[model samples]
Target: MRDKLLMAYRSIRERRTRSILTVLGIAVGIAAIVSLMSVGYGMEEAITGELTGYADFIGVFPAKITGTTYVELGSFTDRDLKDVQRIGGIKEFSAMTFDSAEVEYRNKRVPIFFISGDTKELESMYVEPVGLKEGRWLRENDYKGCVIGDRVANDYFDEVVHVNDKLIINGEKFIVVGVFEKASTLYASDIDPYIFLTLRATKEALQTDEINYIMVRVYDIEEAEEIAEEIKEAINDNHGLDDFANAMTMGSMIEMMGDVFNIIRGVLVGIAAIALVVASIGIMNTMLMSVMERTHEIGVMKAIGAKSSDVLSLFLLESSMVSLVGGVVGCVLGAVAAKVISLGAGTALGIEFGAVVKPEVLLGGMVVAMVVGVLAGFYPARKASRMSPVEAVRHE
Candidate 1:
């Protein structure tokens, strides 16, 4: 084994320029696979992580009206809420109403979103208590209190708002109680430029007794789909239409997102495979050229006691060694490329992206390189082993 490897090493050393170029060809393919796949993996991880809180939660949206052009799904009535509350498997739930309004702090006015909900139920649906950048969350008894999002406090106005500051919304004055941390999502900006108020306060200000949507937390995540169906049926029966309301579970949404990423990963890997095919062809051509150039040397070896197997092993080993080096260099380059690209893109988009370099991905790149080497070298190695000693010597 040592002798075979030594022979291979010497052969490669004698053709340094050709060997280096061949290695670069393989390296380019492997690097592309590693870098592109890493980015896909990273995006999947980021989105999935952000959605963890919604794993067991269900969303209820009003159904669209079929016949009416100006009027569609009406707001949730008192009866609708009462019916949904009676559904089994519901651990907790909260109603939400949203409106666009201008908030005045001192003499400065800024337009912002107003989300109204039950304070405690809001905390329960998110699983974890609201994460605060400063101050505290709203309390049930604090009807005059409000919580602003991170962007509202820092970015919405000329002066930054702080806890305990007084603000007027639609002629109603309230005190700022807390600020929520920025929320992350894949295709959307952070959820940090809004205001949160209690259900009663929002209702009084909006002059509406209807709820826009309901956020439901189920007892078990595994039963989320079943619970959603039950909720849909219950709401539809109350409204006398199957499409009066729609229920969606977070788990199903996550699975759909997983399918999207799977397709993306396959397409990206396919593109990388093209580069690998080109590299494989380069290896085959280089090996065949080496055989033609060393025809007489092969004949001399065959004229002696060296068997055809020995000559085949020598050539195969040389090709494998070149691929191995390329694979290692490619792994390093790919990882660096992923990091640099992630950083640049993350900054420009105001999003967090981390390049994921999984162990299996690295190992797969090496295995592919090695397999490509053997396959690429096989025909050329066979030609060298089959050379007749007298004919090869006479030809050159």
Candidate 2:
């Protein structure tokens, strides 16, 4: 084996240009797979962590299907909320209204997400989990008070807002009671750029009682999914519409996200696999050319008592060595590429997540390259080994 490897090494070194190009072909394919898959894994991790944080919580939204498209049809009514609240296993629930409105502070106006709910219920159900950065949660009667997210307080306005700061929401004045800590995930409920108000205040400011959704917390998380289904049925029945509303638990959301990620990852990997297939073809062409060029050498070896098996092994080793080297280089390039992609995407999306390249991924890459090498070299090695030594020597 040692002698065979040294001979193969010398052969590759002799044709440095062709060997290097073939190796690069394999490397590029591996790098693409590694980088894309790593980013997918990282995103999956971030979203899964965020969803798990609300594992016992369920969100009920008023929605309907209109000609194959799901849309937010109408606001949840008080009757719908009453029916949902009567469902078994619900520990607590809160109705929230969402709106997009302009907030003015220090003579500057900014469009912001304006959310309103029962202050105390909202704090225990949503705010406390992410925690407050400063001040206190709004009281149920603090109709003129609000809590701001980290981004809204510091990043939105030219002036940094603080607790006790007065802001104008839809022309109505309200004081900042608290600021929430910055959220780490990149989901819709990030809370880092939101402003929360009491239900009464929002109704007064907007002149409407439009509850967008209801959030429910289950006493037993293990039964949350079942309770969510019951809540959905109850709400739909109360409204006399089959598709009036939908309820989903956090755990179910996570599972749906996982399924989506898996499909995306598979598609990306499949595209990358095309490159690997092309690389394998390149390997086969290179090995076949080597066999033709070294015909006389092969003949001489056979004349000197070398078995057909010996010739086969030598060619196989040469191909495997080239592929193994490519795999090593590919792994390095892949890791660097993954990091660059992660950083670039994080910057563009305004969210932080790292590339997740596991040891298993590197090992799998190497093994795949080896298998491709062996398969690509097989035919050429066989052709070279089965040659008639006398005919081969006499021809060239």
Most accurate candidate by TM-score: 2
Mind sharing the TM-score for model 1?
Answer: 0.79
Candidate 2 residue runs with Cα over 4 Å from true position: 64-70, 105-110, 124-136, 150-165, 347-350, 386-391, 394-396
Off by over 4 Å in 1: 49-54, 63-74, 98-112, 124-130, 141-145, 164-175, 183-189, 208-210, 302-310, 332-356, 382-396
Instruction: Provide TM-scores for the models.
Output: 0.79, 0.87
Candidate 1 yields a Cα-based lDDT of 0.82
Please write out the lDDT profile of model 1 over residues 1-396, one tens digit for every residue: 998898888989899999999999999999999988898888888777667766878988785533223234877778888888998889988888866787888788877887778888765533143377778888877778888877888887778889998888877899998877665445334447778888877777656556778889999998999989888888888888878787778777677678888999999999999999999999999999999999999999988867999889889998899899889988888888888877777776667878898989989999999999999999999999999988877767
List clashing residue pairs in candidate 2: none
lDDT per model, in order? Answer: 0.82, 0.86
How many Å off is the CA of 95 in candidate 2?
1.3
Candidate 2: count of backbone clashes, pairs at least 3 residues apart or interchain: 0
Residue-pair clashes per candidate = 0, 0
